[model samples]
Target: MSEKTSTTRRTMLQGIGASLAVGGFSGLTTAAEAEWTTAKTGTDSSLYDVEYTNAGAYAVGAGGVVLERGPTQWTKIVDGGPTGNGNSLYGSDVTDDGDALWFVGSSGAIGEYAVRTGNLNDHSAPMDNTNNYNDVAVTGETGSANVYVAGDSGKIYYSFENGETGTWNYVTPGSGSAIQAIDFHGPRSGHAVDGNGKVFATDDGTTWNPVGLQDANVNFYGVDSDGDGEATVVGGGGMVFHLAESQWTADSTGDKSLLDVEVEDGDGYVVGGGGTVYSVDTTAAKFDELAGSWTAEATPVGQNLKAVVRGPNGAPDVTVGAGGTVLEK
Candidate 1:
């Protein structure tokens, strides 16, 4: 097998039959929703990605497992057996209609699960088993819904029909690096970041071109848009790039590798290795590290966090590697 295939298989097998549990934290249950907490069916495996929906919050991780969080608590929806096989669900995005959720993982596994009907469907049977789907982005364009997925070996797949049933054609953006995350803020504007610290943008999601940054040593792991053609990309070595005036600007925090970033309430949060979290002041061009600032909030766990998302109330919800850790702050 090739290097890509070998890496993909190793990620999947390492997460198989792993136990997943939520512990080592407190204040999870509010007084009003205590009855809905179901802790018996938790998985001890690592959860790679998570997204929020009208139905609730869904998190996917190793071993093909899916967990759902309702108004009060979390419940396991799918188990690791023949279906999941411990494939690392690295990226996920919910549709605008709040009806469907799409996840991509190792071996090009593209699984779609319906939120209302509880239907789980897999769409990876066509690929040659060499592709590993890593990230997904949804576009709410008029008259046509588009979903783009990026993966290993410099592969990018797109679906115009919302990934229901259609040909997922591949597009090579000339990066020659694995696309780690994608974000579409509007119908015609979006951006994607790769492992080589490069950013690609497209107005129509069809024709993509590179947006040069002053520094190219930053390995961007996640990106998010503001629905106004502006975006922020975060990655390794405390690198943060923002799009303003049709140009990308670089800002360094002088910290460890940043794994993920998210924007909420006109503010941004960048999370990464060594319990590093930085909050960007949108009005300013730099990140402030003053005491008692939001960025100074230390992650309770120090296990190299992989992803972070802003909760409904703008609180930080984070996930880390190894031991299936989930942190809410």
Candidate 2:
């Protein structure tokens, strides 16, 4: 998802008081079970997003820097990535099989990296549009994943044939509001969020419908479209909005804007602000025994966090943020 919020929106978030915690999720343990560990990335460039796959943990950021987390440490695998012209990468996702990683960013820069190999496939600027891409989601195995890209111009550009040049198409979910994030749970089913407080879902990847977040005043920067009626949307003022079918619930974890989130299998992670990290338990909160499902964990840095993703295997969730700060929770 996109990293920086607009100046006008920032003011609105600061002025409007956040509401009480909303009802969602089941209770689960965090913080006590594990702590966040800052990994040394060996660079100071801001890291905007991270994705965990079977191949490894990869991060993309400023100047198109791509990082890989190994057994020993984090290393810069690519400099001036895909475009090789210093276009910052803002969003990324892995294929269903977790074999390839695709990233989208400034100047319509889009590229796919074979996780097992070092090969980078350039798929930038489909249809000759140079708009910035905020986020992306793929819904199939490597080499065949349907690529859905969320553009900052409030459009969704997609390709069914793995982003092949002529196979791409575009659709605007809202009235030209910048689409900050897009996530898919099936081959053609998923959700997206825009800068204008709009939430949209699509069953066929072309026709989008307003699913939730009705009359919202805050902008949503991230979305985890788990299923038809289940999603976690995070945005300004650390707000979290959850959709349980047609009902929508709202709450705030803190005052800092939540830039990104990922929830799956009843567990997830959220990150934002300077060193802000949240462990989300999507299981126990449904029982009403747990009042709030979010738990804040301490971090080792002060850089503004950008994006987060689930960990591979039994690894802790990985979050990337400003100044290239990476943390394992």
Candidate 3:
């Protein structure tokens, strides 16, 4: 498939599922009013992703709106750009030290928020500006500089210079499928998923090789790893796969279309269509179907949860999705 077509299909699926969760925005409604507190983001735009930093938290969504959690309340950071519905922010990631923040969006738009420097730089045009940038992954924690961007048509870009030099080198092509999500486990080791249900692994964030999933043909929308070879991927048809050693163990919830998965405290939590979130045990090296048994957890909200992350400190996990909803459990 072509790059534009692949990315459009991926985005359309997410938009359709999430739209069905809520008919329309009704002033920031949560499934369980008491379970999750609404952040009062003001706008009713659909929020795609959120990230927590040591300084605070940030959420990005449609209309290029970005909400920053302040000491007392959530504030919108000025983008100083367009004010239409076409400008949307999809994915975001914060640096290990919490000083640097980055986000990617429609038409390959890239944004960076420098905490100490108090600067918001919009780098919308990339080498391939026509494609939508689906996800962004940064490497550091031990103080290194590398950023990876994944998008339509098996496209992947990397820059050792933190993408500040206006040079994003291309990685070797894959199956030419739209890479929906990408995550890093360590400085170099990482895994990514495409719209064709295929998985790719990289040791240095450039060269990539496909890992087999037997005969699975469902699209994989989200993925996360333990930094080791083991990873949990979720997608359409309630599909979930655990990659252990080199083999893939596939399972499903038989209902909701799983959108995102996160590995936390030896447990894997997945969120997706109809606000469904399932937790599975993954402490072992090799996972069995019985061992990877999953149970549905109570969702704080009913809107299709597009993304989830471990809450700040030891608090509850946070989930964000349709109609400007932000829930902390």
Q: Which regions of candidate 2 deviate over 4 angstroms?
A: 1-33, 285-291
CA-only RMSD, every prediction: 10.0, 10.3, 9.4
**TM-scores for all predictions:** 0.78, 0.87, 0.81
Instruction: Give the per-residue lDDT of model 1 (tens digit) for 189-282.
Output: 6788776767788877677788766366766788875534367777776877767556566677767887778764345467778667676444
The per-model lDDT (C-alpha) reads: 0.61, 0.78, 0.67
Residue 48 miss distance in model 2 (angstroms)? 0.9
Error of 3 at 79 (Å): 4.4
TM-score of 2: 0.87
Better candidate number, 1 or 2, judged by lDDT = 2
Model 3 TM:
0.81
Taking the tens digit of each residue's C-alpha lDDT, what string does model 3 give over 1-329? Answer: 00111221122223333432343223433334435455566667888887765445578887788877553445777443222335688787766555667778777777777755667766566674657778888765313457778877578877777776566777744668888998876556778888776888887778788876637878788987554566778888998887766767778787788888876445556888877877766554344342347888776567888887754333335677888877665
Show pairs that collide, candidate 2: 25-285, 25-286, 26-283, 26-284, 26-285, 27-284, 27-285
The CA-based lDDT of model 2 is what?
0.78
RMSD (Cα, Å) of model 2: 10.3
